[model samples]
Target: MDKIDKQILAILQEDASTPVAEIAEKVNLSSTPCWRRIQKLEEDGVILRRVALLDADKLNVGVTVFVSIKTNQHNANWYSQFSNTVKLIPEVVEFYRMSGNIDYLLRVVVPNIAAYDAVYQKLTQSNALFDVNASFAMEQIKHTTALPLDYAGLN
Candidate 1:
């Protein structure tokens, strides 16, 4: 939460696998203190988890589709069922309940239109939706997992 902690976070965000010694050097601290800070960050839930970023194109699931859904069913049972159904679908990488014209939104990744069609069919069959609209993303202009740290305002 201090300047040194923020610096450590910036370094870890850039590369989670960065050696403790290197990070310590960059942050102008000895290895032990820097490591302790990192450990504290993890224990405090600031560092949730470290993961490897995969190449979707190489994995044969590069195509992205944004699905907007509208549902008339507003009961808890219906919401629970629908949320569970969506969570079980592997193609649905991101799902959210929105407060707008659209009831829900999902970002689905698939290899081709046929695969997306299958996902669409599964969704429609599993839930009673008033409307479902999907738009294929032609390009990914900006995509990043790194979060903005300036908003924290502790640096």
Candidate 2:
């Protein structure tokens, strides 16, 4: 990838619906070449599927909760079952296995505290957890899907 490719990515990150001609003009390339670059980026898996950003408040799911989980069971079978259970839950937007004291971290969004409690109850019933902690987010200062292009090296 080169500087132009990085520029193209940055522009697409801002708005994936940006027309090829518009992106091409910004990157100082013709439409064909710019389109080709985008195709190559997709083929290389650098360009993942584009999606729309939705407003949580407008959807009435403004509550954000960070859930930290600790498990005594560290085997593959336990992990597989727990992962599957979490995957089936719509409120769990993001889930990750961590390298710290917590075994897993989940970012959940819901309409209210009662909804979160229901999710928590479901999780506890599905599996045996050593500990489960949830922290509610009071405010969101910054939120963006755009990643930095500086580390792309070519940029």
Candidate 3:
């Protein structure tokens, strides 16, 4: 909420495992206040979860593809069915409903193009996918899991 809180958040974003004493030192606060602030931030739902980021390549998930999907029907029942089915698919890491030509966009991770093709076929064959188009990510120029910090003015 204040400058210190913001600074703490920034440091935690970089590394959630950062020690309380280190954070306090960085933010010019004592250990107890810093720990309390972190606890309060969690209770307030400002800090969601602390997780370790993994290397996709090392995990045998080297390829990332974005899939644009359009459904035959836009009804509530249809959406419910579609969302439920998509959520169960392991290859689909991210799915988004958008205000564009496509009804949904999905970010899929796989080991190879063949694996992606198989997943794609399985997904479309089982779902009400009217249209599907995929674009592979050639290079990840700037990929950050962190949210933008300029949301102070946002409502």
Taking all chains together, each candidate's TM-score versus the true structure is 0.95, 0.97, 0.94
In order, what lDDT does every prediction score?
Answer: 0.95, 0.96, 0.89
In the range 1-155, model 2's lDDT, one tens digit per residue, is: 78999999999999999999999999999999999999999999999899999999999999999999999999999999999999999999999999989999999999999999999999999999999999999999999999998887553
RMSD of 1: 1.5
The sequence of per-residue lDDT tens digits that candidate 1 reaches over residues 1-155 is 78888899999999999999999999999999999999999999999999999999999999999999999999999999999999999999999999989999999999999999999999999889999999999999999888887666454
> Which 10 consecutive positions of candidate 1 have the poorest summed lDDT?
146-155
Candidate order by decreasing lDDT: 2, 1, 3
**Predicted structure with the largest TM-score when compared to the true one:** 2
Instruction: Determine the backbone clash count of candidate 2.
Output: 0
Could you give candidate 3's per-residue lDDT for residues 1-155 as a string of tens digits? 77788888899999999999999999999999999999998999999999998899999997999999988788998888888888988989999999979989999999999999988988777777889999999998988777766674258
Q: Candidate 3 versus the native: TM-score?
A: 0.94
Q: Distance from true position, residue 101, model 1, in Å?
A: 1.0
Per-candidate RMSD vs. true structure? 1.5, 1.5, 1.3
Candidate 2 Cα outliers beyond 4 Å, as residue runs: 153-155
Find the 10 residues in a row with the least total lDDT in model 3: 145-154
Highest-lDDT candidate: 2
